[model samples]
Target: MISLARKSILHEWRRFAPAIFAIAFSGILLVIQAALAVGIFSTVAVYIEKSDAELWVGFPGTPSIDQGRYIPNRVESFVRMHPDVARTEPFSWAGGVWRSRPGMGDVSVVLAGIDSRPGSLTFAHAVTPVLRARLAMPGAVLVDIADRDKLGVGIGSSAEINGRKVHVVGFTQGLRGMGSVNIISSLATARYLDPGLQSADEVAYYLVKLRPGADAAKVQQALSPKGSNIRYEAWTAKDFASRTTHYWLFESGMGTAFGLSSLIAVCVAIVITSQTLMAAVAASIREFATLRALGAPTSHLRGVVLQQALWVGVAGLVIAGILSALVLWLAKLAHIPIALSVPVTAGCAFLVLCVAVLSGIAALSQLSKADPAALLR
Candidate 1:
């Protein structure tokens, strides 16, 4: 029976080609969009994991580390007072522009400032020893590799930030924030670039590394009442990263764009599948009627239509998978955050099959009205 069904599908390839292509194109679009969204979220996760800090202490009501309020430098000292706290470091964040060339113009850049201490865990774990050494120097900055290429700036290059001289000392591979280029430098340098800048009394936040076997929640409670200007929250590195990912996926416009693209892909696939199956059924009405005239069961006719749908689905899935892979590779080359997970790709293929079956079933309604005598005419 399967062999015969295969023969039938082969016989109708000319009629099915356009439909197959349509479905495949739709699937490719959906997969690519999904991969891009997943990639962006994963980048944040990787950044936090690399930092290896146990807890992030930020301002109260701050939605994300990027938007957090400045904490008093005293907060860091206070947090360090806790026995469970192994080390505490102040982190500052700001945005500015760097000249594209000697006098070309200025392009946007994210400025992240951390304390110059070599023992700081956030710095120690996030950067190499050589880079850390370079960062310790005043006026030195680290630029993300992506920004380096985009801005055409190289290590040892000089750029002006808010009219203040800044020198690039090193480069970070994947340091980015909400789609902006990030430059890491000392807290004092960041303040120099923007003097209205508040010091530890107004530092962006504190990154705390806890002692081994210490409870983060207990440590957080112990440090909670130290200052009214600050609120302490404790999160495992993974949890904090997850929260950051969720913030972008759910709260940012990126989520909406991804969802709309996926919806359009699915809708396009459905329309193409439905129309193709309907046309196939209409053209085969005579064949279906002849079978009925020869005592073939309605169930048999249904099975044949369904098998055709399955064939279309399988072919489309293969094509779509290939196209998606090509797009993912291009994204990688372009350095865009786009990832294709095995489970996600597989799940999408399964969904395509289900959609095909449902579309075929809808087309089956035409089969119910076929009359042998009329088909013969």
Candidate 2:
């Protein structure tokens, strides 16, 4: 059967070539779009990902780090008292108008307030001591590298955040927000800048570090209060990361957009593949009819058609993988975070093969309608 399929592919290489390329292109599209979608989710939860805490305590109604509701600052002290909890710190989150430079009018910015303490964040990337020290200055804020243009600010440049003057003392990479800039400053600065700021006793969240050898689940159970009215919950870092991702991905329409784009790519592959295979079948209908008239078994006839499709699918996957790698390399050069992990790559290959098989089946259905007897006449 394998030999039969190989010969068939070789016989129709020209006709199959376009279909193979189309399927490969479609596979590449899926890989890129999926990587982008995952990247968006990763970016949306950058702070949570970077935090050194083992657990996060947020108001009950809050779905993620950025969507935090105001909670009493005293909660940090209370959380720190837990035997399993090693430390607790207050984080202040707010959105405000940013006026950082010329020609770049007011822009919405997400600001975070944290204590100028070491080991405060467990960044996927490293942070320097100098950058942390600079954040200790009054009215100092750290900005995203990309926001240099968006907020029109540079190192040592000043900006107005929530009507209070602030200096961009440093910058962090890969900290972009969804259509907003991120600025981190001291707790005092955040409170001074925002008129609607909560009392110092209140905070947007409590970052919790666990003791070594502590059971997170046990600690979470101990810390998580009962009753639906209680407005606080403890979430492990991974849970919090997933929660934040879910909020932006599904609740915020990012998931829908990416899903539709992927669906379109698959649909395109199927449509083009089906048409190409059907055309190949049509051109060879007489030959197939001749074989059938000679008493070729139905299984043999089906195997020949199925083999052609399977072979094309295998070829397409190879081409798609190469194309996807090149695209991913280009994305890295552009500094875009399009992941090409092993699982994602393998999944894409499987999906493209499925599409190819389905396309062959569609063409086979067309061939099934041909009158082998009439052709013999």
Judging by lDDT against the true structure, name the best candidate. Answer: 2
**Deviating ranges (above 4 Å) for candidate 1:** 1-3, 41-47, 115-119, 123-126, 215-230
Candidate 2: 10-residue stretch with minimal lDDT = 119-128
Per-residue lDDT of 1-377 in model 1, one digit per residue for the tens? 45545677788788778768877887787788788788876665554566757777776655555666666666677678888888776778777877746656677776777766666656556677778778777789988775667777888998788778888888876565446677788877887776657553577767788889998777666666655644555555656777877887889778888898788778778877878888878887888888888898888888888888888888888998888888888877776867677898887888788777777777788897667887657
lDDT of 2 by residue, 194-218 (tens): 7776576677888888889998878
Task: Score candidate 2 by TM-score against the native.
Answer: 0.91
For each candidate in turn, the TM-score is 0.88, 0.91
Q: What's every prediction's RMSD, in angstroms?
A: 2.8, 2.4
For each of the candidates, give the backbone clash count. 3, 2
